[model samples]
Target: MKDLLNRRRLWVGGKGGVGKTSIAAALAVLAARRGKRVLVASTDPAHSLGDVFASELDDTPRRLLPGLDAMEIDPEREVEAHLSRVTAQMRRYAAPAMMDELERQMRLSRQSPGTQEAALLERLSRLMVDDDLPYDLVLFDTAPTGHTLRLLSLPEAMAAWTDGLLAHSRKSERLGKVLAHLTPGSRRDLASPFEEEGGDANHDPRTRDIAETLLARRRLFHQARRRIQDPEHNGFLFVLTPERLPILETARAVSSLEDAAIPVAATLVNRVLPEEADGAFLASRRAQEQSYLSRIDETFAHLPRPRVPWLPTDIQGVDALERLASCLEQAGL
Candidate 1:
């Protein structure tokens, strides 16, 4: 876990309601205290980073402490922005006759499945590939295990999708050239499907734009994917409690990430009962927790597993998060 701090990016994920946000916040604070400028962004739509920091947060980064910054991405806004950008670009190159239909399709596509995720991934890719980011480290407080896994897997999927689009565009360009040579008439007869009539069929700007856009998106996805899979540059931390369902789900999540070539840096077991706690109910719960703790050790023995004792009260505000950071430091994380 200590080595994980050396990485430039960290992604924290786990079962919902497992304090993943709190753990991510603690890590951000810890890194900031260590003199690293850290930006912790919440990718979960049901964001609680603002609640944890006791401050209002939005899409823009907000300073939470001297060197710590936080933000909660608004997925709906990202989707709208993404569609708007696409619409604007298409309007510039699309045939005038297609404008009404294109606008209608774009509006309808906003509610399509995976549209929100695609928009979110575009935002994430921009953040990861931005060379001028001010922060030294970026921590992602991700959604629950399944959603985060899908999010992390998106670059590859999108790259494949973009590759297909580029291939088809290139094929269309070749077909247009062949048609222009075979047919003797105005260039309008040989215009590619994407181009306006009477335009240069051999070098259609619209086809070039489509190909360029897809290729550029593919390049960005590749860049982000490389950075995410590089162990020296990125860390994936799984936060879970010592319980049956969370433990099982985390194991599966770790397996899925590893299969995607993304390394799981460490496992954090939160809300463990303290040994000093007394009472029949508490003692029994501790015994149950011990069993699950042993299972966690056995399941993830190859990775660092840091256990955080259950706090007497809910952790909120900077001070409590700082205390949790201290606990993490003491555990050598």
Candidate 2:
């Protein structure tokens, strides 16, 4: 098979309780079988990748199927790592006790939703830059509507924040140096602790560099968002069940993505009733499905539509998932 996956990332998201994860996993499996290295990642805090794959996955990618790997990230872990880096930078000139107290306070501040998401994005950027485990395709199994929107909008939000932060950082660095040189006790008071600890206190160039890198990371968010909207590279798939509420939710999601100018490549209507009209129960279910499927067509006329019929057995193991993949492929996904 030839390579079919694009280097651009795929973002799978939709209303809460939608089978977004299942569809994302199927897409990754299909792409992998098509001879592309793929990573299907669960970016949602309440992740279910392990459950879907019937195996545990760490922050690092673990091979699940042929040519496909999976990773489940907990933003809390990323937040803790970010906090450590921040404290290390501050400890260059701060006293040990003072640094500890500052770190404690900063940890409290990171409890905010915005800070947690930023930390996760920073970690994700690092993974993207890593050369060792580069994959042809990346699928992000995102959180529900509200959280997913915040994650998607991080690019614009972080861009604006980065501009202001860069300016402020530069101004503060200059002010700090001037204050240290001009004021008698200012240099000694701040520099003494680091000097005693054998730490370089010449305003610590590393800290400045890290601040610049963090600002650059904010730019990476914008780049990632652009990659998502780029038709040749990224594919955004919104998954929904065949029901009135999920159908309505999918419509809202498509509108939101369009409003943000994010390109949506496809939609997956998951767990639909099989197209069999034999029994009364089955026939009634199929009728209901046809009704919503028509509704889906009207809403998602721009992209390809994929459907997953309800199977007798649960989709858990690789064998079952492969069956699911076959069904998706047959649907022209």
Best by TM-score: 1
Clashes of each: 0, 0
Model 2 Cα shift for residue 84 (angstroms): 0.9
Residue pairs in clash, model 2 = none
lDDT of 1 at 267: 94
How close to the true structure is residue 110 of candidate 1, measured as C-alpha lDDT? 89
lDDT of every predicted structure (CA atoms): 0.89, 0.76
- Please, what are the lDDT tens digits per residue for candidate 1 over residues 1-333? 577788888999999999999999999999999999999999999999999999999999998899889999999999999888889989997799999999999989989988988889888988988869998999999999999888888887898888887778777677766676668674754556445545453366777777777888888888988888899888899999999999999999999889889989999999988878999999888888889999999999999998888888788999999999998898788
lDDT of 2 by residue, 2-25 (tens): 122464577888888777777778
TM-score for predicted model 1 compared with the true structure: 0.92
lDDT measured at residue 18 in model 1 versus the true structure, 0 to 100: 92
